[model samples]
Target: MASEILAQLQAQKLLIVNPRRKNGLIIYKKYYAEFAGPGAIVGGQFDCDAIAVLPVGKISLIVPQTPEERRQAYKMRRQWVKLTKQITDNPIPAERAQVILNQFEHWFDAQTVENLPDEAFALLVGVLPQTITKVRNNGLF
Candidate 1:
């Protein structure tokens, strides 16, 4: 399997920077190698995790993205955003919560989130107040 992957990589003039030391590779191939797929000899088929045949040029990779890798990354990102929202919105009084939400939205619009330091994030999390219950005084209540 290693040899086959190596051969395909070499054929496509693709570079595998920093090859993995263990747990074999996840190869991404074109859906129809007959046309857009590699025009090279292929070895016998074998399965380890999942088998995928994507359209040619569908993936450009320094390292192929495994199913688990993609899922874990998305999950972590979702959790991060959820934590940030919970810290900023759920606990603070309505006025203060809106202020924080606006600030966060501004940070996002200004493209500053990427540059924010760990200290800034930690401060935000640390200062979040306990959630305040809102009781409606109107007839709807």
Candidate 2:
């Protein structure tokens, strides 16, 4: 599932930066990457506890390891809030945001490759378009 998501993100030209260990054990610590238009910066991390997505600027959607990790994530969330605000404050066009979200959905879908039930597949088909609309309207990049 992760590989599929990784492929989609890569296909979209999003940079994927994974932390490496000397033992060649891709420590599932943090996997982060980002995609930007002509002049944008995107990056993120997947750690022992969470998967973080920082598309533009520093705003992030962090999926933590466990309920306990939420406390630590709170600190990271503050940083993301500051970064996201900066990205949104920029003079980027609205259309650009849509492009980013479209890529994000592709990535999100990839993340669920393993256990995607038939019902979920239908739900995704129905929900994705609306979700994209909401993201576009909200200018969430």
User: What is the TM-score (0 to 1) of candidate 1?
Assistant: 0.23
The positional error of residue 3 in candidate 2, measured at the CA in angstroms, is 33
The global C-alpha lDDT for each of the candidates, from Candidate 1 onward, is 0.32, 0.33
What would the per-residue lDDT of candidate 2 be over residues 1-141, giving only the tens digit for each residue?
344433433344222222121110111214222222211212233222323222222222223445455444444444433543443453543433444444434544434322223222222222243444555447555
TM-score of each: 0.23, 0.24
Candidate 2 overall lDDT versus native: 0.33
Per-residue CA lDDT of model 1 for 51-104, tens digit only, reads 332222222224324656544433533444455556456453444333433444
